[model samples]
Target: MQSPAAPATPATPATPATPAGNAGGIDPIVALPARALSQEIHARRLSSREVMTAYLDHIARVNPAVNAIVALRERDELLKEADACDAALAQGRPAGWLHGMPQAPKDLAATRGIRTTLGSPIFRDNVPAADAIVVGRARAAGAVLIGKTNTPEFGLGSHTFNPVYGATRNPYDTSRSAGGSSGGAAAALATRMLPVADGSDFGGSLRNPAGFCNVYGMRPSAGRVPYGPGPELFLPQLGCEGPMARTVADLALLLATQSGADPRAPQALPGDPELAALTPASVEAALAADLKGKRVAWLGDWNGYLPMEAGILALCEDALKAFPAFGVDVEAITPPFSPERLWQIWLTHRHFLVGHNLLPHYRNPTRRALLKPEAIWEIEGALKLSATDLHAASVERSAWYQALLGVFARFDYIAVPTAQVFPFDVNETWPKQIAGRAMDTYHRWMEVVCPWTLSGCPVISLPVGFGAQGLPMGMQLIGRPRGDLAVLRLARAYEQERDWVGQHPPRALL
Candidate 1:
């Protein structure tokens, strides 16, 4: 934990003059949570076109500074989406959960008639003829497509810089990074460029940027949200797409619209829960405030393999202590497996996937140059791995999963700092070190985030507190496998108890 920086005087951005005495109007539409706008639309207090126009206007205003959005549909096309929503209203018909909302998807997700560059020059002019499953569902539910958000080249790195669209700066501070490969999506949400955005996480793509930008992000359990339009479409046990928003409620709203089992998935199960039904009020009502009667554990420092920032541990400690105030009996608990072994297993699995799927692109000088060196390195490393090594790693991964059963026996939830340190210089590839210990790998410091990724557990990063430099910090709440609602319930209660939603960045342009 780094020492807290001295608190500075709160600075406000020069308030833009309100048009036509509309004091409440003209504020960034992107800032309003999705649920708020949906309610406004359902009540007919605001037209869908008005919401779409406000966001389009904001994108015009801020895209230069952040480079968050990639492609905007023609104005007529956007108006058509809004017109359809208005027509439904005229017919006395109810729109779906996200009826008439505006949103931006990561460029990695295919969008029909919209160019999805994937942050590479090769696909700069490429446009898919059909929407990916998730995008189609959102559009059918009445979510107007605002544009495409940026990503790292092929979404291979943690930072959101690429040749096609360039870099997306942190909304809080221009010089700092917004975090990546979901960096642009997080940046858009933080600055209210969109009320809600879509993001995918194979590693810490979703959570990292959320923590970096002080927003709520969830990486749902594997198969919770279907992913496709990629080379490997059937493997639901690995990566998935989820939602990001300014608040948990908005994230839930978007998740509900996009989540379900696709017929294409062989392992797909029936009855994906509707996310819209999980409201903040309903979730809070379900969560027990006091953990005193419940068992809770904190995997502090993960057996001391990774170094944490100075105050990070303290902030987490304070948050954990407060859980007992909510009646959770808090105690320290250890996993049955070693952290080193788990890291090895994770590396093995990740390398094989990347190597087999992505290595050939690295062989082409043109394609190789378009990708980040880190991505190439990962592929090359994976290519060299032997079958014996992969088999051993698989065995270890299973053993680790079984080890988690013991922890589940005594505790209902596990807590850890979302990232080892708070947001750092956005220009760097990854944090070089933490608390003086050398961070040798690009993803080493993110070890706390990997356990849940590997185990396919439902995890949510809640804005717990702030640390040095006035930047926000979050603690991850890890739930038992398939306990998505339970984790969200606890997060909703904390949000109500803490009321951290109103904390916004300074208005001054840096």
Candidate 2:
């Protein structure tokens, strides 16, 4: 992949700047939520050119240390797009939802004319001639393409590190991980380098990194946001692409643009009519989602069956207490399921799918050496499974889903910690252990996230507060299957009282 160009001086603006406050070299416009910024741009309170310039300056100044944005488009071309946006607005043409915002697609997603390495040396210079469905949606919504963020090699493990561009460090602490495979997206959001970001999740790629970086990430209900295509179309509840941002409302805006009917994806849902019709006003209005009289179940560590690091349970418990204050009845509850069985099922399906899709690369003489150890382990594990084993695992997954549905029958929402542990050292590919228990595999440390993924339910990771070590801790909110709108509403209500989403990492880390 091409290295990001040296920060270029922003082009002269075609329209004047907005009246927002500017202090400490930070553009006050950058602090505004994406929804609000879109309004400002439309109202002529801010120009698309000015907004894009501010973000470019911010990215140039802050991205080097964390290395979240591994590749970039020339500043001049991005500014030109922004200028065209302003010109259209000047002519009184209606703008799309994200008009003029700067965004970088996750490396795993294809982008036309831009290098999408998927963090692998083998495809280091590969560029697609077309945009992934999600990227097309964002561009149609008026987002100016900046570049692609970093990810793990083939997104094999939760951690985001690859030989192509190296690891993406947490913005909170340069020495620690940002979490993956959405690590770059989360870190970019935390540092205010981009207004909003896009990511995909399977086994906590979206939620874990958002937790680690103190941002908000949503794993929309299966089929709510459709993935375009990949090596294989069918798998055991494979990954879903979703939105990430500093605020739930911003996330809502991005989601609205990305969620829609796609004939190519047979699993795609006919999304919420309201969400499909979402506007800036609608997104802003969702912030007032009523929490009164709602029933919430707080499942902390699956009743202590799931291993977690020190302070995580207590931190999550304290975070859930706010639900009561929001007028929701909150109680500790255990969903019926064996954590061990669920983990085994998840591994069986995940390994089988990944292995089936990627094994050919391993066998190829040209690409064999490019395979990472974690990828090899997963593919080999898949080799040991029989057809009967896959069917049995599918049956177990169904049982797990039914058990979660039983819990949902008793509560409107279930809350849990987003990760088993907080951010670990960036240099380490995966945690050796958590809470004194030796992790049996590179992915076992993130088993807390697999249950929700396995259930195919809507999940959101919200920044609650910090840990004893000052790294961010996030709590997960799981909605019943296909309850994407409801889950987002609950998150919006909670975000109203918490300032965690608005908090930024220490400036020193940048």
User: Which lDDT tens digits does candidate 2 get at residues 285-365?
Assistant: 755666788887777777668788876776666666666677877777655788889988988988898787788888897
Tens digits of lDDT, candidate 1, 1-510: 121122143221121222222112336455556776777788888888888888777777777887787787787788788878888987887557577888778999999888998888878899999888788888887778878988988787667888787888876666777777798998887666777889988778888788777788888877777777555665435667888887666776677777767776554444455444554335334443444466667777776776888667666666665565555666776555788888888888887876667777787888877766677778988888999998898788788778787788877988877788876776777788888888877778787887778888888877655665556666788888877767776776667656444444423122
- Whole-model Cα lDDT of every candidate shown, in order: 0.73, 0.82
The window of 10 residues in a row where model 2 has the poorest summed lDDT is 11-20
Model 1: per-residue Cα lDDT at residue 58? 72
Q: Following a full C-alpha superposition, what root-mean-square deviation does model 1 have from the true structure?
A: 4.9
Off by over 4 Å in 2: 1-25, 508-510
Residue 367 accuracy (lDDT) in model 1 = 80
